[model samples]
Target chain A: MKSLLKKKCHRAGLIVVFAIAVFLGPAHGYAKAETAEAKSECITCHTDVKKLIRLGWKIEKTRPKPGKSAETAGKG
Target chain B: MEPYEKIYVKPSFLKTNHGKIGCEVCHNGDTKDPDWQTAHKGIIKDPTFPDADKTCGECHEDITSTAKNSLHYTLAPFGGVIKARANKKDKRVFEKVCQAKEKHCSACHSSCGQCHVSRPDYVAGGFLAGHLFQEKPCMDTTCASCHGGRVYAEFTGANDEYPADVHHDKEEMTCMDCHTGKEMHADATGVASRFDLPERPRCEKCHPDVVSKKPKTSSHAIHRNKVACQVCHAVANKNCFNCHAGTDKKGLPYFKSNETRMLFKIGLNPNKTKDRPYNYVVLRHPPADPRLFDFYIKDGLSDFNKLPTWKLDTPHNIQRITPQNKTCNNCHGNVSLFLQKNDVTDWEQKANAGVVVPQAKIPKPLKEISPKWKP
Candidate 1:
């Protein structure tokens, strides 16, 4: 009787584990896929903004007097 | 200052409905190409501009349609001022000046994408929260990005001379709390100035009892419609001086402010409408010089004197107790507090003829401005 009861309890524990995995497994996979998608092909390098501005990136580069002040103004 | 990070897309944003719609839906780039250059080919970068009706309007038709005429998008008032300032007599010069205005001034204007999707182009456009189509774009990033120079700076006590506006300092209120979506979208007000907007913020809107009825405070009763609120409430704030507009070597628009300094002055109201019926109002200098667009065409702003350089101003820096409210003499008979003839620049004197107060016009110090209350 004890052995039969033990076998039933073990079977119940297995079912619970399988149920938890069944619930969480797809969610885990979905999260990973979403993360992968987040690293978009667009962001794989070359920003549309950077390419447009790369030729004359004055604000961050030379920091012209007005640019410097405007930047400092924002610091306020 | 990684430029790439400015345009970075976050993982969280990818999970949003907008991101789920995919890039090609709005951006329309060739995603199949492995090379970034090739992939970016045939891309409709920022399809929201000049034709948001086709892109954003597809889903947000009502908003996009009405927003086309909004102050933010058209920047019509500023454009009007630009056009008004130009030499309208010479058609060729006017066209050249307008083209220059387009190159320089137009960049400062807002678009649907600039506000809703990304940071403003004025601040060098970047993705906001990894390009989330935020219902209300973050205030600090979007609105403050443009108004940061004066309005936001003063409101937040970023100026060392001034304290934060009570709303910001105490309540921690962001701009949208008062500005609202209707204000941002600016529903079809057939008016030029924001001051003329019917839905413009009124102090009475929040503090009705303070001004609506005969209040216990005698001063409130005395100054009901005579003095503007900012005259008594606002502290010293920055006023931008000559803003000369020009283009860089690459023909990118830029402006240089010769000076921006803290000032507080009261002047006669320039445009006293029904909403702002006050006879006296706080006047602050805006960045205007008759020669603003001179770089493009000689005397481009030949008609600059049509509008006052020192316009009616409502400074964002508000306080309950300011120096002006301390005593009757602090404002009344305070010649220095008012915009005197000397205060106006030599060239701007003509423009500000209506704004400059004469000695005779100054109000006498009242013996009893407030009988009931000390404050």
Candidate 2:
């Protein structure tokens, strides 16, 4: 009876571990890239996933001031 | 000038790798040399014209060759019809007729840029999305702009008499959904007609049960080999008549067509080609006269009737449950819908050779037949 209880406990522990892996697997797979180069490489192949990075960078360089319209910012 | 005309304002895709390169690289104009007239000098309107290899080939080599060889680019059907109708005896007259068609009808040729970017030239083309590249082509500007007057109109129920195709009306399926990219980039061969193309879209492709040798119902089993699907499914379609040819003030060739009653008629298949062996099929009157080429050369299309004016056609209007499927009596004895002797005039009788069904050949009604009309 003690051996039977041990077996039951082992089975329950296995089920719990399996359930945790199944739930957390996708989150681990989709963990953020470690570097900028890795992120850029991912975007290159999956271009449809997001607006291109170059567009954002250019807007950062040329975009108007926080309180001003682009036309007014250009004139200023 | 509009901000779109300035060139660098493009889609995000164009801002990547080779796309980062400016438009002037392919378009070839004097953007750097800024004398107003000089800036516009040597500018290529369509980089994909004449040879797509110079531009589109840089990225898509496989598609470029297939697209170049396609019927839309070659306009092979028009060329085939011209050759078939031309008088074989007089070489000079045939040459002149071909020249006229090349000058006028050839304006509708499809190119890479036409489908992927701008509209066709005939419809006054410009950049469709303020100069952004479109991955999925716009169906209206790309396909319907060319096919609008007849096929598109019929499919969309632009004609008040008929309802739209069940695929389009209920499911909202577009043309490209069925007509695959392989069909657009056809096998590298010149086909005389759209019917002759090996990859032509068919009802059987989608509705496998409809064409099965052993069908679900008795009527389908009986009619499997004898009748075409369109004969049962198609509704009244716009038929063109009395087409007049004239030259515009700019000396450009133009033609006008007048549409007749919207009706369905089953006639003998004009071309009994291997692909279409059925004796009965839906007939369409393409807007062509015996004297279509008269403006260019007298007696040019003298042998026009050599090829039938009433063509075997599958019109866009299709329904799963048509009136013909209602009962055995609907079509089994409906002689009016079948091409009859009196249907063709004396002048056109020769052209409509096998189309006119003999009164005796029509199937006898199953039971005690009530005579619907006086024969």
Candidate 3:
């Protein structure tokens, strides 16, 4: 019983750590995603997406292609 | 001299006189330093200074007199129609039409640098040094600012419709030609103290030729007769149509009689048609002779009944009755017929031949008409 209680307490500690990471870690990440979307809209005409990203715009993921790509095939 | 001897002698004298008094009593060290000669050169024994009025009014007492009589001081200082317009929300726009500065008497009456120092372009630097008599820009741009086109054209001779002999052009007169400090104030108040009337020489300054050739007795004669020069030669009305063509009450053009216009052009007003106090003589008519009476009819007995007729001489054009010379009784018949008609009075019969012919002795009047008569 003592071993089981100790195991349950360890699992609870992992869940709390996971919840804190999900809540705090993605706060800036979500802002970065929103910024990237806004930047993409600006870069369609500008063609200098890298300069905007260096100027504090966080670009995360681009639109995926329908055809096979190395990164998409790896994800699959 | 030895140093001890000089110091002892001066120190003894200073100790005897000044040791009893404070150091500054003799030296004035507290109030002013004796060694500061350059800074204390103009230091006064008494430190009191007169007020601004006493300092300025000493030299500018005459300015006070001039300002009292000046139009700018008398008329402008008190608020009037022009001042009311100047202090408005749209002051900049209103300044384009009326002068905003001239509304106050203090603007002109104050010391020179008060108004003129900033406007160096208008008044030269002498104004800042309190020289009020220096030339100013009043007649030029300053007057033109508010007076605008009217005064500008007058001074520049843009409106030269006046006759060639007009005084304005002859004298090269500016806006100050007729108006001065005194006369301008005369408009508001009934009385003014200053009068600077220009003499005849001022007019002769431009009209030298007219003045030299002027009759010696002209002025005296005019004065004796109480006649003004404007009576004969003056602009009756500025607009030609006003006098010649007539105008409505508002000075609008209207039709006028040609006869009336012609008479007015000759210095006669047709409306006032009373005869002038002058003389007119008529010559007498020439004598009527018998030769000119060819159209007369004769009525009498026998050949005497022929109408009396006359023939006219070509050159002299004299009219005479009867052929050349015939006796008196050749046409005369009974005397009663001459008395019956009584056409010719005694005076007429006497004056006929330059002789007093008696009425009863004259020939009888013609009775029956005859076709053989000359008439």
Q: How would you encode candidate 3's per-residue C-alpha lDDT over B12-116 as one tens digit per residue?
A: 222332222332332232322323234235543211111222322345554443433344434332333233323245545445323322321223332222222
lDDT per residue for candidate 1 within B280-350, as digits (tens), equals 99887887877767778788778989888887888998998999888888888888899999998788888
Q: Pick by lDDT: which candidate is best?
A: 1
DockQ (CA atoms), all models = 0.10, 0.01, 0.00
**In model 2, which runs have C-alpha deviations exceeding 4 angstroms?**
A1-76, B1-13, B16-18, B368-375
Q: Report the number of the highest-TM-score candidate.
A: 1
Q: Rank the candidates by DockQ, best first.
A: 1, 2, 3
Residue B129 in candidate 2 has what lDDT?
A: 58
Candidate 1 residues lying further than 4 Å off, grouped into runs, are A1-40, A43-76, B248-252, B373-375
> For each candidate, what is chain B's TM-score?
0.94, 0.89, 0.26
The docking category that best describes candidate 3 is incorrect
* Model 3: share of real contacts kept: 0.00
Candidate 2: residue B278 Cα off by (Å)? 1.5
lDDT of 2 by residue, B118-149 (tens): 77665656566545666667777678889887
User: What is the DockQ score, from 0 to 1, of model 2?
Assistant: 0.01
Q: Pick the candidate with the highest DockQ.
A: 1
Error of 1 at B45 (Å): 2.9
Least lDDT summed over 10 consecutive residues: which range in candidate 1 chain A?
A67-76
